[model samples]
Structure formats: C-alpha cells, structure tokens
Target: SLVKTGTGELTLSGDNTYSGGTTISDGTLIAASVNALGSGDIDNSGVLKVGEGELKNTLFGSGSLVKTGTGVLTLSGDNTYSGGTTISDGTL
Candidate 1:
C-alpha cells in the first residue's frame, strides 16, 4: 500500500513489487521504479525522493529508513547496492 495524504504525486514502472511498508505522511512525492523482495520504508515528516530508480532485491528496515524535516533525500541509480541495507539511524 502506497498512501500520500496531501499534495500527491506517485509513479511506479515495470518490474515493480512492494509487499508492505511504504508510507509518506505529509507532503508526499514519489517517482518510482521499485523492485522489492520484501521490505521498504520511507517515513517522512516532510520529503522523500528517489528519482532514476532501481532498488533491486530489497529489504530495508532496522532504523526504518528515515528522513525528517527540511527534508530532501535523493538516491541516483547505477547498480545501486544496499545488500539488505539497514539504516538504523545509528549511521549506516
């Protein structure tokens, strides 16, 4: 489930799979090419952005992949590796 409450724009292209855990609570914009094997989370009090996308064979949790306030987070793509990327907010 992908839910954006206000000021919304969302897009997902081919080979896209998200089983659970994608949320943008306030002021949301997601332009997507997401391939999920299990878990993915973007918890924002403001903004979360990933353009030019390929998040392959994914599982991300731990600190739950967070960005808070005055927020602009962008990940550009070319063989992007997170190896089951765990961002625990302890600094990955």
Candidate 2:
C-alpha cells in the first residue's frame, strides 16, 4: 500500500498487491503494469498516466485519468471510478 503526496514521479512497473487506495495529491502516478492500481479507490487530483498494460482495477473518487507515453494502454475491468478518463495525448 502506498500514497504519493509529493512533487515527484511514481511508476508502477510490476504487479502490485496493495489493497490500499492510490492517492495522488501533488505528484504523478504512472501505471506501467496491468495490475498497478490494485484493489481500492483512486483519489487523484494531480496527474496520472497509463504508460502501458491494462488498468484493470476498480477506481473511485473524482479524478481524471490521463493516458500518456510511448505505448498502448488498455484500460479494462470492472472500473467503478467516479472521476473519468481522458486521453490528453495517447491511446486508451
């Protein structure tokens, strides 16, 4: 379980088994793996990007997910996130 609350960059490149929610208060959370989000809600008001793999996790809160980087991101699964999805500059 982890929470990003600083002016830094976080990249998820492996299968995360954390049940805690991912909160990006003032930084970047990158989803580089399919199971990066884990089992929890997402409260992101800063920045989030899907570099690769599928964000196959149920999302929560009112934050937008922006896809970026140099690969295809497949967002699948029973997503219950309240924010929404946006392709600022990439494929979803």
Candidate 3:
C-alpha cells in the first residue's frame, strides 16, 4: 500500500499497478496520468486532486476531493468520503 503524507501536492504520472491501494493521510494527491493511482482502493483522509483519469477503486475516508484541469475524471463505484467534493475546472 502507498501512504501519502505531509502537505503540498504529489502527482502520480506513471502507469502504476500496485494493488494494495493508496492512503492519502494529508495534503493533495494528484493523478497526472491515466492509471497513475493503480488498481486498488483509495482511502483518502486528505485531498485528492484529479485531472484526467478513470478511478475504479472504492474511495472512502474523511477527506475532500477536487477535480481540476480541462479533462474528464471517471469515477466508478460508490464514494463514502465524509468531506466534500469540488469541481473547480474539470469534469468529474
């Protein structure tokens, strides 16, 4: 599993294939590539920023999500995050 901590922003731009999932404990995690987040669940306790990608993972946590850029982010499955989601410039 991958745990994203601290402040600022982190961008994933490669074709990741880790199945253990991802945990965003703080700051922002940005998916710069299509399959940057891999193919697992995402437990976000911070902020998840997306530009263009398809998320088939189950997103669950107490963090917020932001969709930016000028692309489409396809989210599949039920999201149970307690925080809020804001689309400032992109399509979710």
Q: Write the residue-wise lDDT of candidate 2 on 1-92 in tens digits.
A: 57888888888877778887777877778877556777666667667777666666655555567777666787665665566677765567
Q: Which candidate tops TM-score? A: 3
lDDT of 1 by residue, 8-88 (tens): 644443444555655555564444333321245544443443433333323232212332223233343232222232222
TM-score of 1: 0.20
Tell me the tens digit of each residue's lDDT in model 3 across 1-92.
78999998889877888879899999999887458887778899999887777777889999998887888988886878888989988788
Q: How many residue pairs clash in each candidate?
A: 0, 1, 0
lDDT of each: 0.38, 0.70, 0.84
Better of 2 and 3 by TM-score: 3
* Comparing 1 and 2 on TM-score, the stronger one: 2
C-alpha TM-scores of all predictions: 0.20, 0.67, 0.89
lDDT of 2: 0.70
